[model samples]
Target: MKPALFYLIFFGILSGLLGCKKDHVENVPPGQDWTYDPTPFEIKAPASFPILNIPVGNPTTVEGVKLGRMLYYDPVLHSDSLRACASCHSQERSFTSDPPVLPHVNLAWNTSFLWNGKVEGALEDIMLFEVKEFFKTDLEKLQNHQDYPKLFYEAFGARTITHELCAKALSQFQRTLISGKSKYDRVLEGTNWVFLTDEELNGFDIFFTEKGDCFHCHGGILFTDNSFHNNALDASPEPARSAITSNPADVGKFKSPTLRNIELTGPYMHDGRYETLEEVVDFYSEGLKTSETVDPLMKSLHLGGKHLTTQEKSDLIAFLKSLTDTAFIADTALASPFH
Candidate 1:
C-alpha cells in the first residue's frame, strides 16, 4: 500500500472510533428530589374507561414508579427472599397465578380488594398485608440492604425503609397497570381492523342479551362491575366473606373479578374448580346449581342456565379469548426490574 493511503486509513479508523464513542448512550441516575419539579403520571384511558382515579396522597412520580417496579419484582420483600409479589401475580398469567384470582387492573377506581371484598382500603394498603402475611417479608433484610435504603429515600424521602413506603411504591406501580390494547380495543378504536367472526358476534349477542346475561356482572370496559355477588359457586366458599362480615347476604358472594384477560386466567372460580374455559362455559351454559343466597341476576337458575348449544359455547369461549392482550404479558417494562 502507498504511504499516503496507509496514513489516511489509520486516521479514518480513529475518526470512526471517536464517532462511535460520541453516539453511545450513557446510564444516568434519575432525579431524586421528591419536591423539585416532580415528574407527573397520567393514564390514556381506553375508549370504554372513564378518567382514572388516582389517590391524591399517592400521586404517581417517575422515581416512585421505578422504585415500585423494583420492589414488586424483588424477592427481598419476602421471608424466603425467593418469592416476590410476582410469584403469584405474575405477568405471564395476566398477573394472576391461576384462574380464581383476577389479574391486577385499574385499581385506582376499585372500592374493594381480594376475592371476597373484605379488604376495603386504598390500593396502597394491599401491599401492607402482602408483605406481612402473604409474602411474609423480612424488614431487617430490607432495611439492611445496600440498594433499598437509597431507593426508599428517593421514593419516600426516608432514609430508612418501612412497610408503608413499600406499599406506597407498590401501589404507585400497580396503578400504572392498564390493559386496553386488545383486539377488541382495536375494533372499538377503529381503522382497518377485521370484523368479528360470525361465531364471536353471536357469542357477544348472547353475552349481552338476556339469554347469556353475562353483561350484567362482568361487563363494561374493565369487564367487571367490581361488585360482590353470590355467583352460586357454593352455599359458602371457605374463609367465606360471611365469616368476616357476619352478613348472610354476603354468603356465597365473591367479588366479580375483571375478565379483561380471562383467556390466560383459567381454572375459573374462587376455588379454581374448573381447569379450562370449556368447563367454565359449560357450567354457565347448563350447570347452574341452586344456592340459598344466589344473586337475583342468576335468573337462569330457576330454569337450567342459558342452555347454550355446543357451538354456541365454543363461540362464547372464543369471545372470551379475545380479551387476552399479548402485548400486555409480553411487555418488558412490566417484567422483573432487577435485570
Candidate 2:
C-alpha cells in the first residue's frame, strides 16, 4: 500500500474513534498526573424498593461519593463558612434536622423537593439549585483549596472546579442515603425474627387502614405519596405550595414527608408547630382546622379528625417509633468525614 494512503486512512479512523467516544475527559493540570478511573458504585435498597434512576452523565462512584461526603459536611460551601448541607441534615436524624426540613433518605425517587415542592425533577436538579442558588458555592475557594482540587479531579476528572461538578458530587453522595432497614422493613422482609409488638401492630393497622386515616397520604413502602396536601393544619394558614403554584387552592398545601424515622424528624409539620409525636397524633385526632384546600384524603376532617381513642394514639405512636432505623443513624459512612 502507498505510504500516503496508509497515513490518511489511519488518521481518519483515529478521528472517528475520538469523535465517537462518549466519556468526557477533562484536561490535566500542568506538573500534575491524574487518571480518570472511578470505581462504580451500586446503591443498595430493599427488594421491595423500586430501582434508583441514576442520571446517565453522573454515575455513582466511590471517588465521587467521597468528595461529595466531604463537601456535604464541610462548611466551605457556605458563605459564612459555618454551615453545610449537614448543618441542617444530620445522619443521626435520618438526614432531617427538624420540621420544614424533609429527610434526604430515599431521595433518588423524589420527583420534587422542599416542603412546598418548590424544586421539581431529579436529584441532580435539586442539587443544582442547592449548589448554585442556595449554597452560592464559591468555585474560586474550591479551586484554591489545598485538597479540593485534587479530590475534584480524581472524582470528576475536571481540572476546573465548577458548581455543576460540586452539585453532581453532592448528588452522588446523597443518593447513597438509602433508609429501608427499619423495623417496618424487617416486618416486610420477615427477617431477623423481628416482629411488631401488639400495640405497634394495632397502630400499624390504624395507620394502614381507615381507622386512623393515615395511609391515604403516608402509605406505601416509602411512607409517603411524595405529593402535597393540606391535612387541615389550619383554617387559613400561611401560603405553602401556593407560593410555588401561584394557585390560591394550593394554600396551606405541603409535601407529605416520608414517615420513616418519624421518631426523630420532628418538630412536626412545616412550621415546626408540634414538638412530639403525641402532639402530631392529637392534631390529627381532634385538632384539625377546616380549610378550602384541605386534602380530600382527610375524610375524617368533618368529624374534626380520625377520632382515635387514647390507646389507639399510643399504639400508633409505637408504630411510628418502629419506623426508626437505628442502624441508619449510626452508620459511620453517613457520619461527617471530618469527625
Q: How many residue pairs clash in each candidate at the backbone level?
A: 1, 0
lDDT of each: 0.78, 0.89
Q: Candidate 1 deviates by what RMSD? A: 9.7
User: Please, what are the lDDT tens digits per residue for candidate 2 over residues 92-124?
Assistant: 777888645888888988999998999998888
Give the per-residue lDDT digits (tens) of candidate 1, residues 162-235.
Answer: 77778888988887787887777777777485567788878778878887889999988888898888766654
Q: Show pairs that collide, candidate 1.
A: 99-266
Which runs in model 2 stand beyond 4 Å of their true positions?
1-31
What is residue 112's positional error in candidate 1, in angstroms?
A: 0.6
